[model samples]
Target: MNVIETAIAGLLILEPTAYGDDRGFFLESWNRRRFADFGLDLEFVQDNHSRSAAGVLRGLHFQDPNPQGKLVRVVNGRAWDVAVDIRAGSATFGKWVGVELSATNKRMFWVPDGFAHGFLALEDDTDFLYKCTSYFEPANEHSLQWNDPILGIDWPLDGLEPQLSGRDRVGMPFAAIATVA
Candidate 1:
């Protein structure tokens, strides 16, 4: 696996080496020992998968008391994944990173705790999968406004409008989000 750091401090972009033949290809999506070599011995407690239509936007969400560090990838179709650092006092706070993750690219994104995560499906029936370092605690979850001007997330919504949930639509603005200690 090739590990590349994103602009944010702990955020990483991973590309697993794939071995191919005339028949097919094989690659290890996650390996504990290999990751530990890269200083990432994260324990993934949960796996989540979702399929979304084009224009569907889910999140900018994070847990407060028990934050979740995520390893996300696209299994089918394409998506524009984004992560915004919300760690108080950090130099990159309020800054975000965006990348196009697709089945063809087979790249993985590591959005560690202290960040809000979201994705926009660029194609219909996009399958999104993620491994989480912590169990989800709904009560501790909070949403950051995806379109908040201060944060400036450049979502690739050229011809279509973003379809958001009621909870997500009412997400807190950057100034309204409480600082984490």
Candidate 2:
């Protein structure tokens, strides 16, 4: 797999090497030694999967007390995935990077701890999978407003309204959060 660093510190875009023949294709999605060689020494403890339809937006979510470092990929369909730096005292705080992930592209994203992770489905029945470094802690969960003016993320809305959960719709702005490294 090729690990590509993003503008934001600690974020990475991973492209797995695919070998195909008449039978089909083969690729090693995750290998501890290879990931360690790339400077990602995370020990994923949990795996989660979710499916959403086009226009569904879930994100800008993170846990404070037990932050999760995620390796995210799209198993089916397509999505516009994003990661935002929220770590206090970081040079790239409040900045974000986005990438298009799909079954065809077979791209993956690595979002380290101290960042908020989210994604927008670009196709119907999009299946998203992720490996997490920490187990989820609901009590420490927080959300940042997806369309906050200060952040100004250039979401490819394309005239469709995003479907958000109650918590996402009521997310707090960056200024309202008390971040501590």
| lDDT of candidate 1 over 55-149, digit per residue (tens) | 99999999998999999999899999999998888899889999999999999999999999999999999999999999999999999999999
RMSD of each: 1.2, 1.3
Q: What tens-digit string does per-residue lDDT give for candidate 2 at 51-133?
A: 99999999989998899999999989999998888888889888899999999999999999989889999999999999999
Q: Cα deviation of 52 in candidate 1 (Å)?
A: 0.3
- Candidate 2 accuracy as TM-score: 0.96
lDDT of each: 0.93, 0.91
Model 1, residue 28: what's the lDDT? 95
Q: Candidate 1 at residue 170, lDDT?
A: 96
Question: How close is every model to the real structure, measured as TM-score?
Answer: 0.96, 0.96
Model 2 lDDT, full chain set: 0.91
